[model samples]
Target: MPPGDAYDAVIVGGGHNGLVAAAYLARAGRSVLVLERRDQVGGAAVSSRPFPGVDVRLSRYSYLVSLLPPVIVRDLGLRLTLAKRAVSSYTPVVRAGRPTGLLVHRAEPERTRASFARLTGSDREYAAWRRFYGMTGRLARRVFPTLTEPLPTRAALRAEVADGAAWEALVERPLGEAIEAAFADDLVRGVVLTDALIGTFTHAHDPALRQNRCFLYHVIGGGTGDWDVPVGGMGALTDALALAARQAGAYLATGRTATAIATDGSSAEVTYRDAVGEHTAGARQVLVNASPDRLAELLGEPVPRPAAEGAQLKVNMVLRRLPRLRDPAADPREAFAGTFHVAEGYRELDLAHRQAAAGRCPKAPPSEIYCHSLTDPTILGSEAAGQGLHTLTLFGLHTPARLFAADHDAVKAELLSATLARLDAHLAEPIADCLAVDAEGRPCVEAKSPVDLERELWLPGGSIFHGDLVFPWAEEEPGESGPERWGVATGHPNVLLCGAGAVRGGGVSGVAGHNAAMAALGR
Candidate 1:
């Protein structure tokens, strides 16, 4: 940890991606140094006890793991465990003052089909659902492996997809058009569309095709897109990565903020601030695991900012007991175990998007909730579990960045109230009633706005994806290298991106980190 120490490579952030890059490079016998600004290294992937004196540990920011390639897990020999949910999703539909809902059972397709029939009034919608996902499943298998290897050209990727109908439905047309055409019921259509809108603020019919990119990433993870909960929370995964990197001879230094990065053709210089003072480190190459906007600022360059506004509200709460659903036939445990959709029907989602786009909070906010303790109770220790405590994480959609720009506190409170009211509509009892109070007697409810995410996580515009998602394939330009190259390339020869801003980068996947290391190695 001495000043003027030269290394083979220097990583600017110690998030999962940066750690992954450092592990790979150092394992290959490169002297790598990872500089992390925060005291801890997991970035948004860490778990912590949010409520004071509460034994419950919640996955504070990024919750699930789906996009992480299995190859990286096997290659790194990580001991991370992910548990699958029994149910895929359940969407509540209120009719005639009664609770009727559609449940997509992961283990029991028959039950799911029955629920679909009861809610949509036919078996045809279930058949269509199978067909649509079947195509995506095939597309996922064909395309996901290519993500870690090299970027394929747009034409090459289309040839790999190899289905004209799928190409037209998923790639050519807006996602809304495809969903509407495929499903008969509005609720079913909305359920299908929710995957495309996660963290992305665009509508189903957005001409820019941002939703299409989002949908593609959501469905293609490990060729199945099953978002599984970490056994001991997300921190377990990153902690393992950090250990692997250190074991591979990577130097990990926390509380070091990278201030600037200057690169020439062959080498790079990184200026950073530690507790003591400013210092400089030299490396043959630099891997930046920060947002594109942050990187631009570090390099003292001006670039047009992408439309990367995050448009969701995250609320994490610990409940004393499970709330009862209005549906008499539905089991509350099964319904809450998976994704529970509230007021997220097609029309409701559309209206919320329109309202948020017009700078007003929707009257009826759309959201989805899931109980993590149902899948893995280990997060709630013996003490909390003995008290019948469970963790509920709610993600409210269409609560865009612009709404919180002027008055973040006011907008966050207003949005949380509206969103909770929307959830209460489907519950037999108010959600607030099933509360677990902290030592101070405050309700165990914490909400994070986009502004808060920006301030804490260094996410530009609070975007979880880093920027507007690009098409996962390569766009070949004149005088450029072959399409089969890593997407982590930067303007400088010795600098690359190892974060969410890289192409084919989003979610908790370490593909960007792996690709950045491979690019650095000239593989």
Candidate 2:
């Protein structure tokens, strides 16, 4: 902890990515130090018992894991366990003034087909759904393995897929155009497009095709892109990473904020602040696991900011029991076990995006909910489960950061009220009625806006991806070598970016961290 201590590598921002990098570097026999500003090291992936007198530990910010690679899991020997949901999604759609549900079962294709038939009155849409996901599944298999290796050129990537038509439909065309052409029903189309829009605010047909990049990452994760729940909540994963890093001889210092980073000809320096005083550390190389904007600020340089804006409202609630669905035939346990879409049909999502872009909240906010407790009851323990307690995590789309820039508190309240009302539309009773009260008798609900995310997690503009997602592979160039092909390299010789802001970065995937370590190792 001395001011002039030197290490082989120094990592700023001890989020999961930073920890991953630290673990890998330390395991390679390099002296590593990780400095985290927060009291805890998890960043957004931490789990906490927010409600008083409640024994529930909720995955506060980032809930599901779809991107953490198995290679990283095996490399670190992490003890984290991920549980898959039996139901992929259960969206409630109103038919003839009576609510009906569209259940996408992971294990039972026939059941999913039946649900689609009942809702759309046809099996054609279900067949299309299979074909579309099948294409993504193939792409996932071809692409996911290459992530840990050096980046490939776009042409090389396409050649690997070997399916020109499928690539053109998914990678070249606008995702919105493809979705519309593939499905006839609005409900099914919305469900497919939702993957593209999560934490991203963009139209399906955006010529820039930002949504396409987002969608690609969503489905290509884990080779099949199934979002699994952490058995002990997200904290368990972070804790395991931290443990791995520490056991590998990496020095992790919490409550220490890196204020500035400067590089000389051969080495780098990191100036940080702690409770007692300021200190400076030296390293042969520096790995930045922070947002690009934050990195620029630390380096005292100006860089064109990415078109990054977080457009979602996150609300975490511990309910006494699952809310009853309006559909009489649907079981609340089954429906809430997977993602529950609320007012998120194709037309509704498009309208919400248009309204938000025009600087107005949609009349009916579109959102998706998940019951984490249903998948992993261990989060609540026997005391809470005996009382029939559950957790409902709702993510409201089209609630952009700009909307809350002027009056953050007031706008957040208004957005939360509207979002809950939208969810209540499909429920037989108000969601508030199933609330679990704290010792103070307050409702067990906590809502976070983009501003809150920016303030707490240092996510620039509250963008969960750190920036607009870019195509994973490198663009073709005349001459590029190993380090040049990697996305983690900064302009500085000894400085690297290992955060979500890097290309092929986002989600809970530690690919950036892995890439950064390999770059530093001259691989």
TM-score of each model, paired residue for residue:
0.98, 0.98
List runs of model 1 lying over 4 Å from the truth.
2-4, 477-484
Each prediction's total of clashing residue pairs, residues at least 3 apart in sequence or on different chains, is 0, 0
Please identify model 2 stretches exceeding 4 Å from their true place. 2-4, 477-482
Candidate 2 lDDT by residue in tens digits, 1-523: 6334899999998999999999999999999989999999988889999999999999999999998989999999999999999989999888889889899999798999999999988899999999999989999999999888888889999999998977887889899888988999998999999998999999899988888998999999889989999998999999999999999999999999999999983698999999999998999999999988898889999954554688889999999988888899789898888899988899999999999999988888899999999999989968998999999999988888999978999999998999999888889999999999998999999999988999999898899988788988888741353345678867787888999988788888888988898888877
Give Cα distance to truth, residue 425, candidate 2, Å. Answer: 0.7
Displacement of the residue 288 alpha carbon in candidate 2, Å: 0.4
Residue-level lDDT of model 1, residues 12-101, one tens digit each, is 999999999999999999999999999999888988998987899899989889999999999899989999999999888887667889
For model 1, state the Cα shift of residue 113 in Å: 0.6
